[model samples]
Target: MDATSFILPLAEITIAGAIINASVHFVPVGGAPAAMATSTGVGTGTTQLAAGAGFTGLLAAATMASQAGVSLANPVHMLLIMLSGAVGAMIMLGLTMLIGQIIYVYGIGIVPAADKCEKDPITGDIQKPYITPGTTGHGIPTVCFVSGSIGAALGGLGGALAYIALQQLGFAAAIAGVLAVGFFFMNAVLASYNIGGTIEGFHDPKFKKMPNGVIASFVSSLIAGAVLIGMAMGL
Candidate 1:
């Protein structure tokens, strides 16, 4: 491997980290409050949601890349692999939100509302009136669902890119997959820490802090990329 190989993979890893961090910002995480129907979004942390969706996407992309005729060197093939990952992630997150929504509406008997905004950005529904007093909100709203879908896609794409980069550097399938998961977690955690707590998707004020998380991921990724290059050299 020469300069281009080293530079390209390093760049991919770095960019993938940044992208993953940004994606987490788009997910709605209501934490403990959401669990009891006192807040919006799914009742989970950002890292858990992101990692779940991202791992699904990573598996999908890896499966596609392993097809006999699929070549990572081919730009079209690469795009398809990434798309496979994105779609997988979207499906996973979509189902999660859908099921959670059902429980929130039917079981909990509360309307889906967003506390961060006065009205729904996508549906134009008034949010304030539906919100229960003393609670931030209840259930996932249309905007949050849309934002989470987008985030899942991005997470999948980023995870796929990292896996691809590792494969390109001559890492075996299993090794690359493991490394990709570790890398994904690293960046996801950075974004989660930046979020500090619950968030209501992209429309939330906390989303403004994305750049800080992105920067942290970028720097950490660069260091991780250098270490990966060294590992590849040993292999």
Candidate 2:
């Protein structure tokens, strides 16, 4: 309605976009190589994995916010909503990694290994020894698992923040939710392209390129935020 109301939501949208982009970079995506056990990480593109986790979180947060006595205007209630989102994302990604691990180990008969490092950064296990001669690595290793979980949590938080901002601007829940989803995807896709295909989470050298993705998301989000503000004015 006023300058203060419009400015706050725009800022939140911009920050949420940047945060979503950064979160995607933390996830480990192996693309085609991961599917055939030739690389480390989940067998999918970065955008897909991030979007899956982010949407789950968004739904979880929305559910929490809709509960009685959970007012978004209250800081504690908002925090609880964001927490629900983070936990939801963690559960989804954790389950995915666990099932994928089971398939890679027992079903495919290959030891879990990391291609980007000599030893597991988190567990300190020697990675080179377990990897097959012809493949880069197999399964979700400790580092990848941890990194993916962290990424999921952040992605969920970002999604929740965007939704919260939209709701704060007086949009109905359904409209806010749809806008948040679109906003999340825009940032996630930008980060995925910056990755250029595959990444082994934080341990991978490609993680160093995160600044590029973040900057891209920032600029794009600012534009999206302005557009949303304009729409809000009409509403």
Candidate 3:
């Protein structure tokens, strides 16, 4: 293989890592608080939510790419694969938020509210009044749902791109899938650490630290890509 082959795939891997890191910042995570209707977002950690959605997307993209006559070299096919990933991720996260919303509203008897902002940026709904005393917020608000959806899409895209880069580097399907999952987790964890704790999606103050995570993921990904390339050469 030529220098271009190595360089291009390496670049894709690096960008995908950065994008995955950025995507995590957009997801709303309320941790233990949301589980008890004390805070906003889904009752989960960032890495788990992101990994679940990202893996779904990765599976969808891989399935699409593996179809007969599908060529990764073809731009149209590539776009379709990426779209498949994004849609898969969106569906998974969307349903999760929806179901969580149902439980929060009907089961837990708490209103969906965002404490990070007085007004939702997407729906322009007032947020402050719905919140309970001594609690951050309750349930996944409209803004958080929207933000999570966007994050899922980006996560899917990043996972798909990383898988594509691995395939381009000549790894088999099984190898590529395993490597992609590891790659996804690495970046996701980096972003999660940057967050430091629960966050209320993009509207939260924690989102401001996204750039730091992205930069870290980029550097880490570059190193990982180099190692993968070396492995490919050996193969």
Candidate 4:
């Protein structure tokens, strides 16, 4: 049946969440600069999602309003488009979450557990291995930030389309998706090179040896995209 009622809320929430994340990344929560001021940005891209989502939402709204002039069509038409948007947004969100999970649990997160010591020596086997930025390369955070933004855009745009579809018909939904994706795509290019050094404090002597941040981002995005596609089906 594709009811417009439930789908509207789902679409809005997903879009809003992504936008908020985008906003946070760019808005700079504290008085200081976002990433560079920090010890190291790591997964700091989550903060920026808010702004991206907000802008995307506004664009979607304008689109739906304009198309209203076209015709007073069937509610079912609106519902179907809304369903598509919902499906798309869910796909994007699921992907980002999956990537986030991977980053959190593996790579930077998978610190070796300190319980495998066998010999009962005087020093007690030092247990956990430390992760100094010195051990990693510059590309790690860079990759993560880039990947996160891609995931956010995919999710947010899907959400924006959902919003328009909920209110109106075909053209509006398409417009919403286009606007959201376009703005985000432009931003993606910029975020790729800039985020790592600024957010994760990549330049800090400690992280000087850390791995490249770019690879992490690319891989994360891949995992996220796959998961999002799976989620879209459910939506």
lDDT of 1 by residue, 28-133 (tens): 8899899999999999988999999999999999999999999989999999999999999999999999999999999999999999999999999999999999
Winner on TM-score between 1 and 2 is 1
lDDT of 4 by residue, 196-226 (tens): 4333222223233223323333344334333
TM-score ranking, high to low: 1, 3, 2, 4
> Which stretch of 10 consecutive residues in model 4 shows the poorest summed lDDT?
112-121
**Model 1 has how many clashing residue pairs?**
0
Point out the worst 10-residue segment of candidate 3 by lDDT. 1-10
lDDT of 1 at 136: 97
User: Candidates' lDDT values, in order?
Assistant: 0.95, 0.92, 0.95, 0.36
Better of 1 and 4 by lDDT: 1
Per-residue error (Å), model 3, residue 34: 0.9
Residue runs of model 2 more than 4 Å from their true location after superposition: none
Measured against the true structure, the TM-scores of the candidates, in listed sequence, are 0.98, 0.98, 0.98, 0.29
Roughly what TM-score does model 1 have, to 2 decimal places?
A: 0.98
| Candidate of highest lDDT | 1
User: Candidate 3's error at 48, in angstroms?
Assistant: 0.5
Report the CA-based lDDT of candidate 3 relative to the real structure.
0.95
RMSD of each: 0.9, 1.0, 0.9, 15.6
Model 2 over residues 132-152: C-alpha lDDT tens digits?
A: 998888799999999999999
User: How far is 79's C-alpha from truth in model 3 (Å)?
Assistant: 1.1
Give the residue spans of candidate 1 off by over 4 A: none
